[model samples]
Target: MSSAYKTSAVENTSKYGPFTKMVDVYGLKILGLGNVGGQPQVSTEFLNKTAETFKLLLDPNAAGINKKSREKALKGLTSYNVIQRVGVKAHITHTRQALIAAKYRAGTKSMTSIDQEQTSSGICDLMGGPTLLLEQAQITENLEHALHTITQFALPAAFPQEMNISSKNGKASGISGDLYKALREAIANGVYDDSDYSRQR
Candidate 1:
């Protein structure tokens, strides 16, 4: 972990229960786990946290309000039609440390040394269309990329070997190193598409 990962767990009032939020040195929040009664809070908070995390992923230097990523993440979050798509079924468990894994992905993916960092946390399988579907024609695709990035790259970095999500049937498998580079490059070049916002148009 290289002391890069920091955990902040708070005991909430009886109404909310306790929750654990994990962040890295960049102030990028990586995970949010519900504790005790907090499990119910996860569904509501997950989307916003996930949005913030995506913004941090794209622009680590971003701070304050990030309305763009938030809005886009919202649309994307609703458009993950995974079963409809013919994506492959595979599983991968990250045994590497969080920081190390992040660095590896960032490095091999050719990320620039962040001048600074700021941050937030669903996560799921990857499902993007041509030209990334992120820097493309819709918010749905953008979300697909965002979720993919989180599920494949970010979650593994956060949870490491325990990245699997249990399902009613069993456990489903989980990305690679190259697509991440593409995401960084596209977003850096201001290629995120916002043509059709889900349920807003």
Candidate 2:
């Protein structure tokens, strides 16, 4: 393996945990034990480091304030939903990487790259040239499409109920000006573009 590949493999494994779904210890040993006659050997420290890295990678708060922007900028989003969506994206990215590695290992492809690079337009692309762009684009497009379904179908179906509201006119309604204010503040400060007050409305 080239130094780049080795470095990325170690980093990714450290971040994502052994890629267990694709990597077979026995098969790796058969390939080479390095010094233990196909028995495979790894240090405990390395394993621990990998665990820590994986923890960081898989954390729902991995992106810190950045992920919050998505929720706050969009209409009718809650903090709870933001964290849930972050988890979903992380899992999807993990699954995509695993599939890539497994396909590469199975010889379905001659070789593949590992690292993701940020483009000038601020989007992410993988190392395999144009194909990586397509893959990432497809993931983004699919997720965006799914969001429409969630809002239109799943959310209404799941939360179909009349929530009571106290009105100043001594009547119960399903609206709250306070909720709108909270949402407005969240959009102004929590989102990326605070200047877009129109979006907050």
lDDT top scorer: 1
TM-score of each: 0.21, 0.23
Name the candidate that leads on TM-score.
2
User: What is the clash count of model 2?
Assistant: 0
lDDT by residue (tens digit), candidate 2, 98-182: 4444432322211112222112243444434354454455445434433432343223323333211224554323344544345
lDDT per residue, candidate 1, 1-201, as tens digits? 212222233222222112233322222333322322212223323334444445555452357646444334333322321110011011111211222333221111211111111111113323443342221232443355455545643444444345433233432212223444454468678896533543432
All candidates: CA RMSD (Å)? 19.4, 17.7
**TM-score of predicted model 1?**
0.21
Q: Model 2, residue 35: displacement in angstroms?
A: 60
Each candidate: what lDDT?
0.32, 0.30
